[model samples]
Target: MAVALQTLVAEAERYLASAKIHDYCPNGLQVEGRAQVRRIVSGVTASQALLDAAVEADADLILVHHGYFWKGENPCITGMKRRRLSTLLSHDISLLAFHLPLDVHPEVGNNVQLARLLDITVEGPLDPTDARVVGLLGSLPEPLSPRDFARRVHEALGREPLLVEGEQMIRRVGWCTGGGQGYIDQAIAAGVDLFISGEASEQTFHSARENGISFIAAGHHATERYGVQALGDYLARRFAVEHLFIDCPNPV
Candidate 1:
């Protein structure tokens, strides 16, 4: 029922191929806790609430898609950061975070999970030239109107997406989960009828309207909830350890 912390991290890195991808934050074990892990709590982000939930669950490790120490974030361990790290260290709960690797993994990636939930047949990468393409180009079984496509997204994600309608029905689509509105341009270049991402920017509307491609801003937290859970389930089955997915919903 228990596995060494090093062993768990090794298994995760091997499963995700984390070393092959370059990411803003370090992947694998970000913080050390107990040497052995029996229970794991997974979530979208490593927020204070999630840490508290993990502590309450008596989790030995916390696995997440979003972790601390980003590319541009302050390095100081103070205030919120200090408190979060303090809680983890105090409870001896290890933190294992995988960002870009989790997003692009073929089996359990966030985009793939979203595609499965939305019934999309993936065709290729949104940006074929990019070495690490996080977005996908795909198609529906049949074309749906912009309105109907938005409805499908709402039903699948359990959250109504902010829709920027285009003139044509959507057959081919491109998508990336979690703050991927920036990839709309790549999707447009790929000549997709619709593009979906977790968050929208001010210019996303204009880009959609100008380019004649529909856009959907599904909730970031909702879109990214799957990959971590998938990873957790995989770990549970592989290592014979208990896994819990704690939902600390973020509207943004």
Candidate 2:
């Protein structure tokens, strides 16, 4: 049986502790839809294709990693923003978003999910105090060569990872899913031997070499797909809602 939209929102808000976010956008129910939600759709971004799919599936709610109303975006709902929101509102489809919350939740978070896939046991938050600490610190069950570790990441993500070996057998590893090369220094301070994140800056190579930590730049989209997918599956099972994870390829 389908659950009320409010019930799903309450569950997700409680699970993610929505108040903890210092987010650029509002974190929940960006657009209200039917009160009784029988079908839900999820995606990384609330793109046009995702909305089209949700509409075709007759979804009552859309959940996503990125939704509209970013901090600095123009307040007027016009152009692309207008179209996205208009479609959902017109179709009576609710939109629910979990951003940093989804990224930081210990069990279903992006970093933790990646760690689980790589056979790494999490130690703790990469930045313990930061609410936006999407990075995680962990260790391999046994130390693996840089090459071997890189292979593991590739196989797990099904995409070739960019590796910068820094003269260390990778046992303690640090990871932040999605464009988190900025956290390399944090990983270094935490005594990690290898740091992995989706996407890297040019300076990352120099920083990794100098800091004595091997680095891996996995694709942003690939690394982030897991957490949201897991969340979608959980919702489907819990509410018996028809949940579909819309995939939109992004190389960066």
Query: What do the candidate models score in CA lDDT, each in turn?
Result: 0.94, 0.87
Top-scoring candidate (TM-score) = 1
Write down the lDDT that model 1 would get. Answer: 0.94
Model 1 CA lDDT for position 18:
96
In model 2, which residue pairs have backbone atoms overlapping below 3 Å? none
- For model 2, residues 69-131, the per-residue Cα lDDT tens digits are 888878997888889888998999998988888888887777888889999999988888775
RMSD values, in order shown = 0.9, 1.6
Candidate 2 has an lDDT of: 0.87
Give model 1 RMSD, 1 decimal.
Answer: 0.9
Q: Which candidate is the best by lDDT?
A: 1
TM-score between candidate 2 and the true structure: 0.93
Q: TM-score of the candidate numbered 1?
A: 0.98
lDDT of 1 by residue, 1-252 (tens): 899999989999999999999899999999999999999999999999999999999999999999989999989999999999999999999999999999998999999999999999998799989966599999999989999989988898788899999989999999999989998889999999999999999999999999988999998999999999999999999999999999997888
Worst 10 residues of 1 by lDDT: 124-133
Off by over 4 Å in 1: none
Question: How many steric clashes between backbone atoms does each model show?
Answer: 0, 0
